[model samples]
Target: MAKSKPVLNVALVGYAFMGRAHSNAYRQVNRYFTDCPYEIVPKVLVGRSAGPLAEAAGQLGWQESSTDFAATIRRSDIHLVDISTPNDSHFPLTMQALDAGKIVLTEKPLAMTSAEARQMAAKAAALKRPSLIWHNYRRCPAAMTAAALIADGKLGTIQQVRAVYLQDWLTDDACPWLWRMDAGVCGSGAHGDLNAHLIDMTRFLTGLEFSEVVALQETFIKQRRKPDGSGLGTVNVDDAFLFLARLSNGATASYEATRVAAGRKNYNRIEINGTRGSLVWNFERMNELEYFSFDDEPRVQGFRTIMCMNGGAHPYAGSYWPDGHIIGYEHTFVNSLYDFLVCLKNGTDYRPNFSDGVANQEVLDAALLSAQRKAWVTVEQSQHFAGRAEPTRVAAKNAGL
Candidate 1:
């Protein structure tokens, strides 16, 4: 005679890389977080082609498929709209979902520009609709452990952050042009796709906002064959972007994101330095954290590698395998969705909501502006971020930092 839980139907857009990742998260969340508050139904998968959509739907475990995105968003049965589409589509899709009184979860870098992100945030806030952005790295158990240690003053008075997200996917001339290489679709290439995570992770680990940045970017190969094999198209986005920033806490930071890093495939790494200690978490070795503490006895002072998968201690660990057992990248998405569902059950606001997206987008747009101008740009570039929620602090300090 247990009380039945209410069902929350999800209509997801896109069925490619992110679409598959998100679909897996939705399916696995309830299974792992058994105490999860709702019966999450992966109701419909929406995409451009009915054939591919149907095939992806079946493969990804969604119950339905549709090509009509507008109709799907308006469906009363759909409680959540998941916009995993390209950067150009996020603002419009989220705005529609918000207008329809549906909660939304979207991929990162929010929108094509800071202005678009602000509008989405304002609309979601005004309509009182809940929203989340899938900055899944913040949920990685090792990353969360870094946050906790930083929050506990292990990394006292943060001084600097260094981050890089590297890949080799676009290093080859033979790699055809796709939506990602087009600025009109993805905002910025490696900067938006890779550094977005680095930027957000810096803010999450230190609880500090960016003050200003000086940046430079480069496009290695200017053109590539179009996806349709219809000759070549201009590659308008940066293949590599590097920037230095001044953080709100007077800390210094640097970031590098590139798709031209030969022999490097998904080397996402972050390191933080403070007065008393330092920590590094590389997604390449995601389950372990390297720690160095000046406070330790001088004889024993060196980096110690701590494995973060202890079910008794690490966040999200108890939900999975036994102590010392590791998890792969996809588990981060599951952890994020599980947290979002818990927030829904308690009627509490979720971190990295629409407002967080606005914050992240502002940093992104500002960096691009700085690169274009070949000068420093403040994170709050006035006209660009007018009427936006202050990006001074993260949504709130959760999971310690």
Candidate 2:
């Protein structure tokens, strides 16, 4: 008889957009990537209300459901705690899960502030628990391919990077206010919710830390009706943010993130220019990577798009489809889950662990600070955690994907 694989039981908190994405990933990851040593069991789902909790449990394939996150996290059967809750709850729940010796996975923009992220990082470091923040874009084959090429000196001497993440969800004033628009609950609106992803992606692909930033933040809709139609509430956070920064490698970057763009529906794009070549990736055309090489004859030099669907040749692509077939946004979550489980099996640290969260939070803080002071703010300020790790080895292999 074959030996049984180890099982890791997961207790998931929250059941909204991120919650559903994570649940789907947990259900699908092991099915496609069978090489991981452990079987992921979605043991329980946690949410605030009874009706939605039960509904989500049935819909998302969780065996059980609970309303109390504290009780769920403390359960002995739960070996891992996945926090997909709102920003305000991330710190407390993550700290509790780590204290209880449960492996933790949380959604991004780790916490409302760097101080909170630092505390979470310290706890994870001290306890040595497997922790990961779901910066899922890092797992996208196209993005991973970009990282591999950059690491291989393909984008030699990075000189500039331009990234813009735009959405139209809140373009109309009638769009009801939610926790995301409130400063206290979800940090800094699109500044954190959207720009955070770009920051992490830039850091991952270029292996460069942000040195300084100057930014401007704006609130287009100052007030909106409450979700329940109770009353109007003040919109204290930014609807848009644009920033300019210098990276540690002496490269300049410009970033713009907003929910008020009229026609951009989930448009996240990045273009990196270097001495030898340039590369561009747009989420709308996620399966293709556009590249321009200086080595080409001057008469013929132009951008060429490579479809990043070559199976087995691309990182995390083979498990999904044959060459030329495309994967969607949801597959990114599955790829990240595969990486997480692999790290668990190998007893290795997960990439973009709490330390990365803290580092990203520091950049967010710098952007906010620069916006407030109207001057460039150094990312390594007094409050920034000083013990951040140096550039570690890139976890993904250099392949065609």
Candidate lDDT scores, in order, read 0.87, 0.85
Provide the clashing-pair count of each candidate structure. Answer: 0, 1
Model 1, span 1-401: residue lDDT tens:
76777899999988899999999998998888888889889999988777888999999999999887777877889999999988777877777778778998989889877787889889888887778999999998999999999999997899999999999999899999987887767778899999999988998899999999989999999999987879999888899999999999899999999999999999999999999999999999999999999989999999999999998889988989999899988999999998898998888898778788877888888888888778899987823533212222211111111
Clashing pairs in 1: none
- lDDT string for model 2 (163-227, tens) is 99999889899999887876767778888898999999999989999999999999989999998
RMSD of each: 6.2, 7.3
TM-score of 1: 0.94
